[model samples]
Target: MSSRSPAPPNAAPNARAVLAANLIRLRAEKGWSQEALAFECGLHRTFVAHVERQARNISLDNLERLALALGVQTYSLLMP
Candidate 1:
């Protein structure tokens, strides 16, 4: 194994909410529209909008892409 402890209970259930809030906040901070962020991350604009709406879950790769485009660590999207 790994040295890190497991995530606390409720972490998994809240990840989508965390990601949605952060994405919206970060996008606004960058003064970017959903389309702009999607273009930067190579995702569809509706996909970005859906993510911000917490309407769907995405793969780790997409999460990383969004974080990179937002100039943040991958974990940042999953954290509160």
Candidate 2:
């Protein structure tokens, strides 16, 4: 029998969750607080928190800023 579990209706897709999850991971990997990332990205710290929580949709420009601050390509944030 298969042990696979059914997907949740509200769960983020693998691709999207990976993107959001990576944002959090990369920040931690760099030993940065959300406030630090916000400062480096020229954004408000609450905005960083909103992004990490997937509560806010970011524009490409903001994504680029975050990528630059994280020392990664913008696409890296979308990795699965």
Candidate 3:
């Protein structure tokens, strides 16, 4: 038999990409600019852009702040 391990069952998809996509959609839905969202989240606009692009790995605390700014629960960001 081959040595490769079997893939785990019911593994979650990538969290960062899911979060980024949700953030982008929510911002668009609200008609808010990245700068505006960042301000509301107490974060830098550039950082928000990076987060939305999934170029930055955001911490849980920052994710919570962004979720709160978007008027959503933190778990919403992780939704598919």
The lDDT leader among the candidates is 3
- Name the 10 consecutive residues with the lowest summed lDDT in model 2: 11-20
Residue lDDT tens for model 2, 1-80: 43546569996565445767988999999999999999999999998888887667788999899999999999989876
What TM-score would each prediction reach against the true structure?
Answer: 0.82, 0.79, 0.83
Better of 2 and 3 by TM-score: 3
Residue-level error in angstroms, candidate 3, position 64 = 0.7
Return whichever of 2 and 3 wins on lDDT: 3
Error of 1 at 44 (Å): 0.2
Give the per-residue lDDT digits (tens) of candidate 3, residues 6-60.
5467866577779988999999999999999999989999999998876788999
Off by over 4 Å in 3: 1-12
- Candidate 2: stretches off by over 4 Å: 1-16
Error of 3 at 5 (Å): 17
